[model samples]
Target chain A: MAVREGLLALLHEGPRHGYQLKTEFEAATGGVWPLNVGQVYTTLDRLERDGLVGVSDNEGQKVYSITVDGVSALGAWWEAAPVDEPPPRDELMLKVLMAIERSTERGDAHAMSVITHQRTVLHSMLQSKRRARSVATTSLAARLVTDALVVRAEADLRWLDLCEAQLNGTPTRKARS
Target chain B: MNDPVLELVDVVKTFGKGSTEVRALNGVDLAVSPAEFVAVMGPSGCGKSTLLHLAGGLEDVSSGRVRVAGRDIGDLDLASRAALRRTDVGYVFQRLNLLPSLTALENVALPLKLEGVGRREASARSLDALAAVGVTEQLSRYPDDFSGGQQQRIAIARAIVVERALILADEPSGALDTMTGDSVIELLSSLPGRFGTAIVLVTHEPRFASWADRVVFMRDGVVVDQTASTVPVSAAGAAT
Candidate 1:
């Protein structure tokens, strides 16, 4: 979340252009979080405006480097960074709830299709995460996030199971609704 | 030490009396070695579950001998049989029957906690067991949070964590998809050789049966066929 501080920490090592900073940030964070060119420029402008970084023309590009105050701010934030709490609602669950409602009116075919679509999406996401794991520098936070995603995928499969059983007219655990 | 993990000699389990009687197991004879992975496979109503229950000492034999872990279950009193189940055998049913409120880790730790292990120690052991089965990440999640394969693994983790001499599972992977079910079977089949815990699994699926180190097919309350896998038999006694 503190994109500026983390990028500033890297700049503290030496002056770096925006492109160089993006590459370093991707390396440090396991490449799971990709920084777009626009996002990087936006953050750079904010940092320069806040006096945490100073930019000067070097060669053909504007090279930005961290100020002394930026170094202390990055250190303090790193030491006391709070863990992100789990959000109260999940979008996938909302989708499933709507699918279940549609199943009653449109027949279980609708529900089965919805689940099949979700399964495909989740599987592709899982493959991407796995691929990232190999090329990316692994970090503790990245591992935890990947684990949470895996668990959510598993839960979706379980829901797919109940839906399949329902479509086949086989008995399953009663729906919550 | 050639003591069989389980042996049933001319065991007949009959329910009801006279003309209304039912013979669940009819003069059955079988032997299972220590730390072996054995699968009991048959069609519905073929007495597979009954055979497992009899072997694990959950039910009494009516006409002959039943021995488990070198102890004649026929000779053990009620109290001792209960103790044997508590300390020597772990049972998993098709339903899972995990407590709803307990997290996956807590569900796995119940048996150890019941055996007098302290809370922290039990949880530590449970976590290790979950990790062994590759379900450690879901340890804090409840059963409802898992896939069918994950839940089955957690059930298995609970069964083998306490180092039970024997583990009995009925349709452990029946609820999972083919790929996930196969993975679970691999996990169960590998567990015994790693921990020296003999396992007797019941399943109607032939694919599930093939994972066992040995297959003992039952029909009409008798062991109709038996075959060993790559591993050597335990060379244990079969006399009950």
Candidate 2:
């Protein structure tokens, strides 16, 4: 879905060849998602076949451009909020929730251990991201991506704390020694 | 079991006497264990600052007990309390209070140096603390030569440089932009694990509060509610 929509959006700017679209997509997303050249051309072919794009002659090379329908489609894509019809099936969430359910059935603390272990991992990830953010001087995009990761890691840690608090009821407040 | 790094039991603080008295805190009870981070959130005039002052031994409680590193603060004499604060507790404020003439390394080393630590040892430890807060390259830069974020890092370095068991921060990120503030909070969150120090952070921002292990809400000089954030781990990843 990203490649198809990304190709449409890139073509919206101007006519770009297939390889250019791939490079531009990679750059826009900070290279987090690498695009296959074959996949890009296949998507372009489908778009052209569906009247969403058109192949035009540019000095002797074939360039892809958005059609009227493609412009309308891109506009629609921009206007609509991304759909989560299937409710994103994240592997980590599935694993945690499943672990919680299983631990509850078994009357064990395995779920709590999972949450704690995950918290430690996320904390280290956050530290590395912070280190990266401090040293990253060349690319604003890279810095922004690292910042996002740090925020996410912090949130994940908060959630793990929440999971422990819920599983154990109120957190015990120990008296001073 | 190990002792809590910070504790307050039925703590009360009054600013004046009789009719003119203002009750800044009333019978507040709290504890922070080593490696724990607790955030206190409230509106203005809600005794959050008073709680921090008591924990850090900045001000004496009118009644009730305040303990740090398992020692009762009220029982300690002035010199002893000052020594406790210098050697066992760390405090960070909205205003960094870094000396303009000192470089980041020197500013961080000042606390240990004041405690009679040798210059070489203090400088080495200060550099380690700065690196922990991700401020290595700016060690030689003075406060005026750095940005708000860098200055705050220096302040944090100074706070933890003495290997203090407890850290009391009062809106330490209050002066920075949202992004920079989040970075500061992230840095603070990492400290408890890295240094095995307990942290009591006072802030009005919920976003900042969410980073703590527990969020305590104070109102009218008393704790009203406490809640652990229920944000799902995957949801956090998806939020960005």
Task: Provide interface RMSD per model, one decimal.
Answer: 14.2, 9.1
Q: Is the docking of candidate 2 incorrect, acceptable, medium or high quality?
A: incorrect
- Provide the overall lDDT of each model, using Cα atoms, as 2-decimal numbers: 0.75, 0.78
lDDT of candidate 2? Answer: 0.78
Listed in order, the DockQ scores are 0.01, 0.05
List model 2 lDDT by residue over A73-160, tens digit each: 9899888998644423245567678878887777676776676556545544544455566656746666677666666665665665
Candidate 2 interface CA RMSD, Å: 9.1
Candidate 1: Cα lDDT at A44: 92
- The ten-residue window of minimal lDDT in model 1 chain B covers B231-240
Model 2 clashing residue pairs (backbone): none
Off by over 4 Å in 1: A1-177, B236-240
- Per-residue lDDT of model 2, residues B36-138, tens digit only: 7778876678899989988888898999998888799999999999999899988889985699999888999999999999989998999888888889795
lDDT of 1 at B34: 80
Clashing pairs in 1: none
**lDDT measured at residue B137 in model 2 versus the true structure, 0 to 100:** 90
